[model samples]
Target: MADVKVAVKILSELKSFVMQVASQEVVLDCFRRSNRDFTRNRKLPFDRLVLLIAKLCKKTLSIELEQFFKELGLENGCSVSAFTQQRIKLKASFFHWWNQVLWQSYYHYSGESTKRWKGLRVIAVDGSNISLLNTPALTKHFGGQSNSHGNFTQAKTFYYYDVLNELVLYPRIEPYRYGEVQMAYEGISQLSADMLVIYDRYFCSYKMFALHLWAEQPIPFIIRGNENQRMVKEFITSGKRSEIVQLAPTCPAIASLKKSGFIITPKTLLEVRLIRVELEKTVEVLVTNLTEANGYSDDQFKELYFLRWGVETNISVQKNIMQLESFSGLTVESVEQDFYATVFMANLHSVLIKDAQSTVNQLSKHKKYPMKVNRNKSFGKLKTSLVSLFIEHQPEQILLILHGHFIRDTLPVRKNRTFARIRKNKPGRSKHRTYSNYKPAC
Candidate 1:
């Protein structure tokens, strides 16, 4: 089918890039901690190590290794100790670079099919906490929080997620103490004019607005503002649906901007549009540089702002479905490796299932509710075929096989799903269980 060809072409592009990365000694050397690393051949070579990490290792190390080798049709495999040592020699930045470049490849190959909103990519910016192992090395590198019960090791992460495309274009992991706004500000340079970014109330800041508006290309953005914000509160008091207002930088924002090499005074003003959207019971204000009333009207603001939820859902998928915190190794390097690799795997899974999703949409048009590919089940199928899709010669056949599996397993698309949030007084670490002897063979 035509869908299978598109899947094959994308997989082949990724395979070629992976091969190019593996074969180039100059590129491989950059990923190595030392020039001596991966210089000689070993059971777990540089190329195999890269692919193995993308496998989403979630079981006992010994069992995962055995299955990985068996999938490659190899009888002999390296020990868990060997994998630990090999991974440490390679930097985690490799996976980060691989993820970014692979996303670029998807966009390049997807062409006109790449989703967009009003001639711009709908990007959502959000931050989340990732629980890290309680090892001294991890705790020392990435700080955690201490409460009445005990100390919990974790990391703060900021993600630039393309909501419409269902891809994480950029991901940043920092120490738990780092601020998300500052992390987001650091990502401003990577923004392009063709992106319209949406943010939640936590990211609402004068400095953030100034950076986006003052950028060379003037990146368009919409940020939800809380009722507590002075600017938002004033807008609500006016009882206007939408208004364009000037925002002056506060002393703290000016100081923060100065540290980032952007000199701004309190007098510096940013012209932003504020829109008020009424919820079922409460009202929320949105701040954005998109002041073109004709193009982006007040009514459209609600749905535009709601798009920010995509990043939150993506984070949930990463943590719950992908088992992101279920780290294979406790060292800082391994943690970083697993984190970025998980992002890559998530994107890969998203790209691979697009064809099946489209087919489901067409077939279910006459049904009561539209249907979608069951992502959890699709992920399992993709994981089993990941090695072959990358290493096997007949990727088209493998893709067709996956397409069949994907179309057969689907779930109905339920809309407007809501749940009440339960607030916990004391924060607790996410509990993930992995048995020592019991591991799934499939």
Candidate 2:
């Protein structure tokens, strides 16, 4: 079990980092829309506003405003309109950089026990659609799909999730017109050789594979390939569990690469290994560069490929449990702020529970099903405690109280539980719609 003192130290470091960032006038200026924003002392200052957004505002704006100040032990709070005015002054990228510093601190202070698979950090790359308020400004900024009825406003999100650590390394919200593959390709600059990234079949492309291999430090990746593809079809028919093949870029792949300053001709072959994994209902082909025959065996590919599902589960949590689509403001800047702030808070919640999870594991080792902290409930507990955790002079007491709550309510992890996916036909209106007036009933 990790020492409770370690978690305490990490929490201290994170709070200090926040204080440091908020204190620097030069740093605050970079996140402001104009030089004059947040220059004067108003009801809401720069640091207070940053913490307010990180609180995961899912309630009515007015009520949330009142409660946020109340939590801080202050009787007075600003109005919703004032909050709206102040939030826009701050750029959304502030939360992005804030989350970057947060996870970096976690990895740094959490020590060497950070989870990895075969000495490599198993990072999963995936994308999901986020429902946004149907307004002219939002719709114009982020285009969405149309139907017989009308168009729905939405945005596409690409994420780099560290599945093992349950941290979102990068959370990006792009215009709905952008393809997931395009976003993934653009995100290649963030990848490192130490991480083994997993992708779904939608990300399978000749150019995508070449980009990883051509990086300054080649990144390792596993991409699920469509069975109908020529190479995959031939390999499937060969009946070999695994085989190394030379993949030649298609004309379109060549064109895309050439435009990106990576000149690849038709004869430019990318040597990749293809593995066949048998699922309960069917066999899936996985394209990868982990071709060492002994290092990663053909039999291990199935479980490694299955690890990609972690990202899918994480996305579901963001949508369902985290209420990620729940925006506090209507503008694009607010949307980005809410998105990145949620990522930061979620990562913090995950890290804070590590010690408690260890305690739960030790206590429930004899139980039939493996027990873990209930994340949905834990998030609520964390939300209420977040202010005190940062502001209290003695945060160790707050940490101890949080640790107790985390382990007190536990959920069982039932392995190999599968359910049929119910695919419903699209209705006249999107089943997933974000209302301008409704607040989440948490």
RMSD of each: 3.0, 2.8
What are the runs in model 2 whose C-alpha is more than 4 Å off? Answer: 1-3, 423-441
Please report the candidate that would top lDDT against the real structure: 1
Counting only residues 3 or more apart in sequence or on different chains, how many pairs clash (N, Cα, C under 3 Å) in candidate 2? Answer: 0
Task: Give the alpha-carbon lDDT of every model.
Answer: 0.86, 0.85
Runs in model 1 with CA error above 4 Å?
1-3, 422-442
TM-scores for all candidates: the values are 0.94, 0.95
How many clashes in each candidate? 0, 0
What's the C-alpha lDDT at position 171 in model 1? 95
lDDT of 2 by residue, 359-434 (tens): 9999998999999998878888888888888788778788888899989989889999887987665544553555
